[model samples]
Target: MSDFFNNKRVWITGASSGIGEALAHAFASQGAHLVLSARNEDALGKVAVKCKELGAGMVSVLRLDLSDHDSIPGIVRNMIASVGKVDILINNGGISQRSLALNTSLDVDKKLMEVNYFGTLAVTKAVLPGMITHQLGHIVTVTSLTGKFGTPYRSAYAASKHALHGFFDSLRAELGDTRIKITLVCPGFIRTNVSINALTGSGDKLGTMDEATDKGMSPERLAYKILAAIERGDEEVYIGGKEVLGVYLKRFFPGYFSRLIRKARVR
Candidate 1:
């Protein structure tokens, strides 16, 4: 465990399960004060209990639905009041899409953007004021390899992740010399329930886990690496197996990368 996160006040969204839940446990082990959020209050409470058991200085659970923009302000206010000031904000909440572009409706795309892009932005903005006032903060976003390279049947989800890179990159530049750090984590795949919970074009759950994800990195290991990256103040990190090559290929050999990615079995 890195001493960089010791005693820091951290907030993690989507903490009910999967990567977010794993991260909550890992951070708590390092003695962080945690504010965990998710749509399921019961699950959040369970996570908080585990976090406390893992040695967190303090654990608070707040039920949050990121897609509901109207409720963000109050949630932010409550967090500020309870935590006093957040040292790190992990924008880990978002949904994935598993539908073909042709079959995807505009409404589906809108919903994806609302939760994955706008929702992340909303939460970051809500906490940024306090960070700026204190002159220090860290914003870590969990994007995907799909954000860097396009994949079949995930157009909307990919677009949302790509947008995160653009937004956070600009934000890092804008906050230069302000002690506010932004780290964009692009993970290829992680063994989690993301695929099962992913939304399809018709707004139904995909309900089946993808093979690649089932064999990918474990959330616990990924959480450890992410915390290490944050400690080193890295601007970006790509965590995955060979899938990370796609990023370099796309940059140096766009045509070759495109053809190869098209043939790859992302699902």
Candidate 2:
């Protein structure tokens, strides 16, 4: 069991599947108390059961739709009341887009922003006060590699991720005096249903996985890295194959990186 997460009250969003589900197993193995949240109540229940089997001391399931930003605070408050204080908040629930900006509808963009940006912010705000009062907390987000740089066929998705980086980075700076730690986990690509469920130009599901995603890193591996980053109190970390190098390339050679991305087939 990991000493850092042992008995910690950790709340994980998107716990229904993919990276979230993998993370649930990883944290449970360390004997953490878990609050698993996702839009699908049934799926969350399944994950909770698995968590218990994996050695979690406590496990609770909460249904949360990130698209319903307005109701997030109420949901979070009720959760906190039942689960006690939240030691860590994993803002991992979000959708992905697969269309170009020119072909995408405004509604699609709005929905993406609402779920990936506003919804995350609302949950963090609702949980922040308690963490602040207790003077101990950690906020971890599963941002994508696109958060650091632009890529083809993911304009809205990239925008939402970039916004997360801006908000969390600023929040970290503002909370410098506090014990609250913010870790932004940037994953290049992970084998999941993100591509299959990605929004299209007309706000429809893409309904198919891409080649890159099919060959991406396993969710379980990414989960292990994320847990380590959290334990180390890393402000930010990248997890993936060669795709992760894009972050450094974009930083050191923006002009070259921009040109290279233009010719790259992201999807």
Candidate 3:
């Protein structure tokens, strides 16, 4: 473990499961003070116990609901008051979608944006002032491969992630030499319950796993990469398998990529 994270206070949203739970373990193993938040307080408790067992400096579990944007600031304020200033913030709480644009409802699209884009923005803003005051902070947002390029059945999900790119990119530029660093971590896919929890056209849970997600990289491996990226103070990093190629393919070969994407068997 790098000494860089030994005493750092890291706050992770969606820390109850999947990538979030994996990250909690990684940070704990590095001896960082952790604030883990998710809607599932029960699950968060389980993760907190394991983090403590892994030798976390201190572990605190707080329930968080991303879709409830109005409650974020107060929750963050309480967190800071209880745990001191946050040194690292991992914005990992988000839901995915698995319906085509035509089949997806407006409410579902709004909900995706509500949680993925707006909720994340709210949390970032809530922490921004504190980080600026301390003059020390690193924010790592875990977006998806779809954030860079669109794919079938993920129109809203892609849009929400794309919004993060736009907002954070501009913020990074606007920060202008501030110590506050923004690292956008784009992951192709990491094996998790994301697919099963994904929303369908009617806003109901898909409750089924995608074949690609079933065979994707492990969350532990991605957590390691994310840890390194944060330590290195990277502005942007992409982690995953060959699907990472889709970003460049779309960027440099729009026509060809469009044709290729049409044949993509994405659920």
Reference-based TM-score of each model: 0.98, 0.98, 0.98
**Clashing residue pairs, backbone N/CA/C < 3 A, model 1:** none
Q: For model 3, what is the error of residue 8's alpha carbon versus the real structure, in angstroms, after optimal superposition?
A: 0.3
State each candidate's clash count: 0, 0, 0
Off by over 4 Å in 3: none
Ten residues in sequence with the least summed lDDT for candidate 3: 1-10
For candidate 2, write residues 1-267 as lDDT tens digits: 258899999999999999999999999999999999998999899999999999998999988888887888899889988888999999999999989899999999999999999989988999999999999999999999999988989999999999999999999999999999999999988999999989999999999998999999999999999999999999999999999999999999999999999998869
The 0-to-1 C-alpha lDDT of every candidate, in the order given, reads 0.92, 0.94, 0.94
Question: Candidate 2: how many backbone clashes?
Answer: 0
lDDT for 189 in candidate 2 is 85
- Scored by Cα lDDT, where does model 1 land? 0.92
Shift of residue 91 alpha carbon in model 3, Å: 0.2
**Residue pairs in collision within model 3:** none
> How do the residues 1-267 of candidate 3 rate in per-residue lDDT, one tens digit apiece?
568899899999989999999999999999999999989999999999999999899899888899898999999999899888999999999999999899999999999999999999999999999999998899899998888999999999999999999999999998868999999999987899999999999999999999999999999999999999999989888899999988888889999999999999678
